[model samples]
Target: MKIFNTQTKRKEEFVPLEGKRVKMYVCGPTVYGDAHLGHARAAVAFDLIRRFLEHEGFHVSFVQNFTDVDDKIINKATEEKTSIGEVARRYALSYLQDMVALHVRRADFYPLATETLPVMQDVIQKLIAKGHAYVGDRGDVYFDTESFPAYGKLSKRPKQEMESLGAQDKGLSEKKNLKDFALWKTRETKNEVGWDSPWGYGRPGWHIECSAMNLHYLGESIDIHGGGQDLIFPHHENEVAQCEALTGKPFAKYWLHNGFVNINHAKMSKSLGNFFTIRELLKQFTGDQLRLFLLTSQYRKPIEFSLDILREKLPLNQRIEAALEYLERNLQVAGLTPTLLYNEAYRGDYGFAATSTTDETEATAEENTRKSLVASREKFLQALRDDLNTPMALAELMNLVKIIQAWNKPPEVKSPSPSIVTIKFTFIILREILDIFGLYPRDSGNLHPAVTHLEKFIDAKLQERTQARKKKDFKKSDAIREELNKIGVEIQDFPNKSTWNWRK
Candidate 1:
């Protein structure tokens, strides 16, 4: 397997430090605010990576960290007149809820920065002994970027260019280099939250916490390290520098970056004054819809998330979902052999031809067109291998679903040999792939939440109208419909049955 490593700016074979075992460390959310759409993209991107790796039969251990201690947490805590841990804990819990709702698998470890201070200090001590960092007069410690010649390699920026950019010295001793970053700041009342350290009482820097957690949890080298592209510059780069400088080993074998879910061609950031939290957005749309929309584009490309597209794209998904559900329902009703797993042998390689034949003899070749199944399956796998090319994989999956629809539908067709092993092979493969992509299993196998609530309200309205009609009031039925219409629900009358779709 190969992945595009940001450090090399090219695709490289993915060989884990341990044979057949993949370890991934994702830079997790800061936990100061509700996770936004950008956060959603990163999470989904890495989630796909883990899913695909597991699909390919590799054991994966994924760990993501929580930055419980930060300026934002402190400020939010102060504003709410609560403890900092309370603020962090509330938001962290919310993030976990949101992640679970989105079907994101729980990581092997989710460490908090505050919980790993001792490990962080140990790493800091190594840097100090190596002369890569030093204690300042004010008792703060700073990483001397000049000490690491490869400091800016990951970001492809020159030291001269960085200095020319006029970055702040950030309140360190005069003896410290201007470009040096703080490892710890001297304890002071002004710095709301401080932890006791060798130099003084201070918390971990944003970048250091991840390195410490990554090394402690996954060790010096791992299979993959992923996060939003925004962290490429100082955060990931510094993590590379600090971890490698201490351990004398590559921090991560493959560095994966998820492109931004851009707004107006600009990266979404708090400083940019344009941030959309995923938790809040999920309130408006289902998690499946959000995951599908995010996966509609390749993970490496930027996504222009717009309201109109979201509206348009969702129903398209609904249509495909509706079609797949139709197949699943009919398949179950037909009582086809309930097999343990789908088997894929003797299936056609791929394409529409695999599922079609104009000649009677060819049609009676005793097959479900092995070629078509192979083609579709190959395309799906290729897309997955190509940096988890979800959109392409999605297109192929939908196409396969259509083919299945065409074959399994009305026209009395010749059934293939029931004993053919490949017949079930194709079926199981598609189902398995779809499951990993989070596009299968249809509605909750019950009424949707929106539908359930709408039904309850409609039932009440119908009872009210039934009473009104008993009193010979035609106006009341029409009035009830109007009331439902105002709240985004619609009713359609049928000869024997009634149903509803969302109202505009």
Candidate 2:
């Protein structure tokens, strides 16, 4: 597998330091508000990477950190007249809930800044001992940018250029250089939350929190370190300096950063009044549809999010679900037992070796269909391996869907249908690929109670309309159809049955 390394500015082959064991660290949110579309994008982007690696037979240990104590969290606590812990707890839970809703797997270790204070302090002391950091006049510790010769290597900015960015915090006058960033910030107000450290009562700076947690959890070096593209500068740059200065080893083998999510061609931000929370979006789009929409673009490419794009995804998601459902229902009607040919235990294998069939021999048409399915599977995996080109992979999946749809259609008169083994194997491959993308069939078993009730209500109305048609009462049937349409329901009539779906 090849990944674009931000530090090298090129795509390179991925080779874990420990063979077949990958250690990855992604920056998590600072729990001050609800998780938004940006957060969802970041989560899903890394989740795809992790899932793909695992599917390739790698043992991945993923770690993400929560900045539970920050200026934002403290300010939110003061504004809401609540404790810092309460504000952090509420939003942290909200972020996790959003991740679950988006089908993002939980990190193996979710260390919090508050819990890693000792670790952060130890890193600061090491930097100070190495003359890479110094204590400021007001008891705050600032990293001495000049002491580290490769300070701007990761960001690729000259020291003078970086100094012009300026500091927003007050300890700038105390720092030896303007480019220097705080390792431990001194609290100005007694009411704010803080912890006792050598640099007085204060909290860890945003950059140091990640560096400390990653070093403590994943050792001195990691396989991959990732976050949004915005963090490439000061944030990740400082992290690299801090870790390498202390351990004198490469911080990470590969640096991956996902692109931003824009709204109306502008960066999504609260200041723009165009920011959207994940919860707000969930009300309109199902989790699977949202996931598919996000994966429609390459991970490193910026995506312009809009309602129209989401609406387009809804029908695509519906088609995939319908195809899978049809495959299952048709297999049952044909009196053929549908077997799951793919198993988790054989994920490392390639081609038909990953799937098994009871019938070894097949007819000419069935063999042709099987070859097509195998080629599609290979194309899908190749796309993912090429730096996580999800758009290409998704196109392959859609192609498979088209092939299945064509195969499921009734054969010509006197023509023999494909073998049951071929049909079952194709279903297995489709489901396995979809599972990697976190798309699952929405069935009654997992439907929300309110939705189930709504579906039952709609079914009853359709049944009533059917009864009206059976009685030859055309007026009653027309009245029932009009009433249903008035409430945003569209019913389709067939010779023997009727179906209803919601109309936007």
Candidate 3:
């Protein structure tokens, strides 16, 4: 696998520092507010990378941190007449819930800034001992940027530009250059939340929180460090200075940063009043559709968010779900059994191998279709390997859907079987690939408990309505349909059966 390292500005072969065991750290939210579309974009992008690595048989230990102690959290607590910890806990849980809605697997560890205070202080003491940091007049520890020669290596900006950018932070004019960032800030107000430190009572700076968490959890070095592209500047650059100065080792082997998410051609930000929270979008669209829309663009490219473009993904998701449903409903015809471990022994293969019962004669008879399926699978993996080109991978997924859809053009008609084994293998490959992409059949058994119960109720009501109509009770049938419609389910009636779906 190859990754585009932001620090190196080139795609390089990925080799973990500790063989097959991968240690990855991603910068998490500050937890002062709800997670917006931009937050969802970064979360989904890294989730894709993590899922693909696991698919390739690597044991990945992923850690994402929550900055629970910050100026924003303090202010929010004060404004709400609550404790700082309360504010942090509320939003931290909110972020986790939003991630669950998006199907993002929880990180192996989620270190918090408040919990890692001792580690941050230890890092600060080492920096001061090494003469890389100094205490200011008002008892704040500032990282001496001038003391580190390779300070701007990660961001690769000139010293003057770095100084100019740092000036925007309103730096203290005591004992250091403008580029020198705070490792330990001194609190000015007694009402603000802070902890007692060697340099007075204050909280950890934004950048130091990450460095300290990484150093304390993942050790002195890690395989990959990632975040949004916006953090490539002063945040990540300062982290490099702090970690390498303290440990004298490379902090991470690869730096991967995802791009921004724009809303209707404008950057999505709270200041601009254009940001949409994940909670709001979930009310109108399914999580799978939202995830697919986020992956429509490559991870490194900016994606435009608009209702029109988002609506286009619904049909794509529907097509994929429909294909898998067809495959499952016709498994008996293809002489296949239902089992997820069709190729459990093929652990490292691209796609799971076909089941043992696949007929060799039928496979030989359907050579052309089988070859097409194999080629599509190869291309799909190739796209993911080449810097996680999800757009191309999704295109290949659609190709598989097209082939399956072609077998039944009119939707109600079943054409001649290409090959029973071919059909079986295609279904296996499609389901496995979808799992790799984190997409699953919504109507399958993966529904939430509440949703599952609701679906069962709907099915029971439909069966009752069918019986009523069979007995020529038109009034009872109409009443059941109205009841279902009141709960946001639309019923479609055919001569022999009725189908229902959530009303769009």
Q: Which candidate number has the best TM-score?
A: 3
Q: Residue 26 lDDT in model 2? A: 99
Which portions of model 3 show Cα errors greater than 4 Å? 171-175, 332-365, 411-415, 443-504
Kindly give the stretch of ten consecutive residues in candidate 3 with the minimal lDDT sum. Answer: 347-356
Error of 3 at 3 (Å): 1.0
Stretches of candidate 2 exceeding 4 Å from the true structure:
171-173, 330-345, 348-362, 410-416, 443-504
| Candidate number with the higher lDDT (1 or 2) | 2
TM-score of every candidate: 0.80, 0.83, 0.84
Candidate 1, superposed: residue stretches over 4 Å from native? 164-166, 336-368, 407-426, 441-504
Q: Pick the winner on TM-score between candidates 1 and 3.
A: 3
Candidate 3 lDDT over residue span 289-368, tens digit each? 88889999999999999888899778999899888777766776656563643455253242434443356776454666
Q: Candidate 2's residue-wise lDDT over 1-504, tens digit each?
A: 889999999999989999999999999998888888888888999999999998888999999999898777878888866777877877887688677777789999999888999999999998999999999888889899888889999879876778877355664337788889999888876666888888788877889999999999999999999999989988999999999989999999999999978998887765576888886787777667778889998999999999887797777787788778877776687775544334532442333542354445545556777788889998999999999999999999999888766755666633345665666667777877877887775621332345457778888978998998999888998998998876557889899999987542
Model 3, position 343: C-alpha lDDT score: 57
Indicate the residue-level lDDT of 435 in model 1: 65
